[model samples]
Target: MEKPKEKPIIELKNVLKKYDDKTVLQNVNLVINKGEFVTLLGPSGSGKTTILRLIGGFEWTTRGEILFNGLDIKDLSPHMRDVSTIFQDYALFPHLSVENNIKYGLRLKRINLPRESIKPSIYKKQKNLQKKWAKEAKDAMKKLDKIQAEYEKELTKKKLPKNKLVKIQQWLDDSDFKYASWEVWPSLMNEKFEKKYLTRKITNDEMDKIVKDVIKLVNLEGHEKKSIDQLSGGQKQRVALARSIVIEPSLLLLDEPLSALDAKIREQMQQFLSDIQKKLGITFIFVTHDREEALRLSDKIAIMRDGVIEQYGTPKEIYDYPVNKWIANFIGDSNIFEGKIIDNDEEIISILDQKIKYWSKYKFGQNEVVDVLIRPEDIEIKKSKGLIKGIVETIVYQGSYYMIEVKHKQYKILVESASEFEIGQKVYLDWTITSMHLMTQEKEKNKNKDTVSLNLKLNKEEISNE
Candidate 1:
């Protein structure tokens, strides 16, 4: 799909929001570029919902700037911000039909969107500019003529040569010489339209065309007249999406929209949302606790904890290279080893007490205390020569695979495999070189700040001696 992306469409800078005596959000900073699918992945009460409300202008930020398209939107209302949200409950009208529910935003009472008129505003400006431009152009030409005559008089008085006149007419002769283009005037954008498509200004034909197009986009073409009570959970979800999308918002917020659907239906809607985001090429911010759903639907992921973002990166980066033990425990399943780096090599690291050789994808300093992470599926238990000896402590059957817990001294390693090993059986634990993830502890990671290099000036004595 062709995504006609631009610079950041929404920015929340140092945003702090509080509800009465409680602070739900604090020092939240984020930038969402155009046409990117971003997910806010975290558990409940992590301030994901609060972020959406702030972006939608439903709730104002207590202490920071909310910018839309590089301009501060502190005074813009929800209707003027051109943002749309689909909530967890779908938020459809129970008494209305699917078509009417889709039309709810167009209805005068529900959303009350103002109409956008492009031509009349631009055309009026163009007309006024044309009138204004004529006098300016005439005055400029007259000034040029006056300068030319003065130069000629100077030339006659001083008896100068005709060859010195080349630089005087540069501006008059240059067609591409730039004056402030009329397009950038403060009045170019129409304030009366309110960045909306109103019901009153739209004719019945235009309204029907717009409503039908959005319904077709949501795949509700034949079920327009069907009542909301008559539709399935998936259909109702789509109706909610259609209602939000019909207004053509610059940013779309989805707050656990598939929480009500069955597993299979929810999976289907995940793909549906991804496809729609690509097809529409609009910035989509999805909020959900489901890790798999967020990984599957978003291009970037922001993981939050206790109303703060713990980490933000691509899904693969979050899964493979978690910053701290807390994030490793939250994002996916893994076995962790707490040991000091005894020997660092080109491709391996030896942990002294563990008597185990780690398959290192990163280099660690000698004697550095760090954590090593290995996914459960990466561990290979077999009779072949292995890195360490382990005793199988427990076996768990998990449908497609069996999870085996092995105890090696002070560490308990988890491994996932198809064959179940007997409990208390001695087995060899081994893993590939590329599968191990080395991480710095939270405090250590924070201590590694970005530094800049500078060039020093030599002293005057040294310079004189040189």
Candidate 2:
């Protein structure tokens, strides 16, 4: 049985953004499903952030639609849409404590009530009654706490009987005073406190629970009272996250939120962000230039370049089978070989007079030129006889593995091996035929258009195969 498809929470349909004569994004089409962590990944000036701003309502699209829950939200203001944004700088209130910062958005938020159902006279009466009840409830809670503490102390000193203790516990449990302010005060005051306010604003007690939950979610429980300036970089980031998520937005836009942190903090925050997203189960559209970070944190990655999404897929798909040579190099280290199809029947390609067999979903005509990519880790280097012989030009230690650059004929190939190899030593290189990936070549003229079209086509094929 197949699982039902998840609904898309946000979609960009041929979205284009322009500032004066400079075009920021052109023909951008993307879909972010609910509860998926999608990353807009690219180098600087690739318009990744521009797409984020457009979806966030910080910027408007020049010639396309931005959809939220399948409806066009191009005209909706940032506050009007159920979306939140966290910037790189954390955008926290320096003077405000973490709790206050998280509460800020909820305080400004309003819930609509039916005016016909709530009369102004009745509303005013309930407003006063609510305040009276709130005070009474707080006083009752304090009395209950004091009484319970005194009883507990007496019991600890063996001055109170066990029968008395049991009766007291039962009485306390049965009373409304046992409930927290958020859980009990509202009902005691008015069954519908929201209707009491003409402006339909959240009550202080309601906002308190929301802020508290979000603080705990981001792991900033003990630091809620600390000012923004007192927080470390990661803590400040959590505060920013809590503030944005407190309003319960349908989508969260994070623009390089961890870029400002140092290496150790950045990695810690990445894990923290991933955990929080999973716990909340909200759509997160993150933007970052760090390829490794994107691979680690994203369920889907949109690789943007020159104001266009070059490819959009899972990290493994983009890394193992990029659409073009540019993406292959940009995504990760690869040994690329320019070749031509020698025999279409056998799927054979000629690379530097060496015939290599490869497999690809896309077919090519005989004599058609193509590019073959094999990752360094995919290639195995042996000191004995193999398919091809080469001289080890350079060897660099990369913690777990050694990166050996082997010179085969006039071409240089990289191999990742756990065994050590000496420079200028004779070595042989080999890999399974399935490890070789064929990619489309980029054309200088109409490059972006071609890349986008090919990417769409390739993605369609990939989906069909799946």
lDDT tens digits, residues 1-466, model 2? 9956889999899988899998889899998899999999988999987898888877788887878876567534455478999998878899999999988878667766668867788778877887888788778777877887776676677566779878877876655325443335544346445534544777888778778888878888899889999989888988898888888787899999999899999999999889989888879999999999999999999999989999999999999989999889998999999989999889889975788787999998889988889999999999897889999999999999999999988999999999998999999988888889988677764646888889999999999999
Off by over 4 Å in 1: 1-6, 77-80, 107-189, 193-200, 343-352, 355-366, 443-466
Model 2 misplacement above 4 A: 77-80, 110-200, 445-466
**Model 2 score (lDDT):** 0.85
**Cα error of candidate 2 at position 171, Å:** 73
Q: In model 2, what is the error at residue 233, expressed in angstroms?
A: 0.9
TM-score of every model?
A: 0.73, 0.76
Judged by TM-score, which candidate is best? 2
Return the lDDT, model 1, position 252. 94
**All-Cα superposition RMSD per candidate:** 13.6, 21.9
What is the C-alpha local distance difference test score of candidate 1? Answer: 0.77
Residue 432 CA error for candidate 2 (Å)? Answer: 0.6
- In angstroms, give how far residue 292 of model 1 lies from its true place: 1.2
